[model samples]
Target chain A: MPKHILRLIILFVIVIGLFLVARQFLIPESFGEYGHYRANSIEENANHDIKYVDRAECAECHDDIAALKQGGPHKNINCQTCHGPGNLHIEDPTPENIVKETEREFCGRCHNKNAARAKLIKQIDINEHNIESKCIECHNPHEPWN
Target chain B: MELNKKNKKTRRDFLKLSSAIAGSVAFYSMFKPIESVANRKTDVTEREHWYGFGFDIEKCIGCGLCAKACKIENDVPREPFFFRTWVEQYTIKNGHIIKDENVIVESPNGGIDGFTQSVPDKEIFKSFFVPKTCNHCYKAPCVQVCPVGATFETPDGVVLVDDSYCVGCGYCIQACPYGARYLHPEKKTADKCTFCYHRLKKGLAPACVDVCPTGARMYGDLDDKEGPLVQFIKNHTCRVLKPHLNTKPKLFYNALNEEVR
Candidate 1:
């Protein structure tokens, strides 16, 4: 009824109208497509090239080594775990790219005596346990401690 | 008398106008956040993935390869304190009365390098490495407490943070019971392990899973009943960390030590 009241009502209506118009543009296209998030995120995450190749791929070529590793202490260990990522090597086999791990320090990374390690786990002090010989000389990584 | 009547009419109009403006302001303020809720986007999809993590305590040799791999993969700071994932070595002695014996828990440099024995050989009774990461709880406190919708759980059951959206309020960091989250030093946003969400989506095992010399850590789809993770969970006596909190952590630990928190 009042002039000022009419103006206020008109202003409020305008604000609401603007909000309704803007909201459509503000929200993402894929929002709420999957749960409460953007659906395209799935496709985005899947875009990266995989770096690590699993054991199944290694078994394709190295069946002998795979057979030796199975049922052994190191059965659970993947070939790439020690040899390093094989995606490049799988594409092109090369001694320079995919070589057997020969360094004693590589083995020492896990087997070296450490107080934090479980007591039952066989650990070498190196100084006390065959310091003269390399780990692979006495222990075959495929069937270690055999 | 006529002029006074006109003045009264103007005053009434002014009161009504002021009230209307006040009402509009209040209404706008109330609905603004709700509208933002509709706009708020999480970097997640409705994909059917039931991601789960399994840790083998007995298998862990405290070699820290998992931590190292996780750090390198996630670009976590190489510093000891800023760990996206870490391994804690727990050593306990004294059999029956465990409290009577010495119990030591140490994770030097987040166990990035293999740990050196702190206690002597004979003195120690039992020790094992517990690999730690974001539990990605079904009912995550971090998701609940985030001021913004920055941190959220994906349909695959992976909990992740949208660094772009995070306000760096640190609520998620504090809410995480497992201490999985930290305010990233440079990014200033809450950062935690996404179970290598990027890696998972790419059809590869997580970096930690790939690098673990011993099969101490495992990740797989929980929905796949025939999968190794489901089989492992079914076969083994598995326990999650801090079950009492009721976070419903997806990370299952086999042979979890009593001393481990």
Candidate 2:
């Protein structure tokens, strides 16, 4: 109701707006690039949890898996998808192992969906695209992406 | 100007001084010509050296192994953009040079795979595997047209991008007629076949050459006369990927019958 109070409220709003606007400019681009932004991610319990692992570390003892990677469509797929958590595997190197799937169907967690572009991998095809068999039917999981 | 008689030195003395200066200069230069050292080993000879690739068109099956192997080796960026290498399976089917594009494939379905084709033994097709790689042209248009000097030809003749230098102008993208280059999204650089220089330097074969069930994709030093490529050149007549671009593509396709062009 008073002009002085109205001016003070407008100034408060501007300060809040500036803080929000400058958030991106202050934050590093790579800050959130790697992880799942959703609230349900595995690491959400921690105050600061950013988890990721490049594939080479997985190939260490999983030479069979690595060799299989050489033979599969998932050769290019980042191993973290089906391998579950990676930082723990890197630290322990033994207990958190790859939960191998029955067939090539295991490779489809991220690949199963159509992406931003028209689907490069129609992994959903066995059910949706009308392909006769699962992924391995025409593919060799150890040597797939070409 | 005032004329000088006694103030000037004798012409004979000046000639003697000039001759002595000229003789010393000649003697000093004769002993050292540019101070060249023993020939240094080139980066091309090092692990980064570029090896030229050529193909035998007659033997190509259109199996798409070259395209596929590149995707595996590089983890090619996906979709609406077929990458790296693709097979142009040419055939005289239905009385036409039926060109089939067996490009890079991501396989939930195994649609298209590589630059070399791997037709099954039981199947019937008038096709062969013609493996393709970056042509590594001497005067690569991709290199010359880059607005940011991102794409550059190496001393070894392989045209490469200094991804750091790339501004994502996409000029090199348009300049390439062969469709050899693409804009890498994460890095925002122009990416293309490096001819697997990293492996070649280790004395290992390119991934496609390694995976080819048939020994279709081969790499060797084109400059070396004793190299397998020169030996093959001497033994058989082959064709370069595109002669008209005048890029002088090192990749050669062999065994192309006149019928399949």
Best by TM-score: 1
lDDT: worst 10-residue window of model 2 chain A: A36-45
User: Tens digit of lDDT per residue, candidate 1, span A1-146?
Assistant: 78999999999999999999998887666756654545555455445455556568989988998999995788877776677667688889787777487766667668788765555567778657776777888789999976
State candidate 1's TM-score. 0.77
Candidate 2 regions with alpha-carbon error over 4 angstroms = A1-146, B1-50, B96-111, B114-129, B257-261
Candidate 2 residue-wise lDDT at B245: 77
Model 1 chain A: weakest 10-residue lDDT segment is A42-51
Off by over 4 Å in 1: A58-75, A87-105, A114-121, A137-146, B1-47, B95-101, B224-226
Candidate that would win on lDDT = 1
Q: At residue B255, what lDDT does model 1 achieve?
A: 94
DockQ of each: 0.35, 0.02
Q: How well is each residue in B89-189 modelled by candidate 2, as lDDT tens digits?
A: 43223223444442212222122332212333233234433344577787778877776455665546556665545679899889887778888878887
Q: After superposition, how far is residue A115 of candidate 1 from its true place, in Å?
A: 6.3
User: How many clashing residue pairs appear in each of the predictions shown?
Assistant: 1, 37
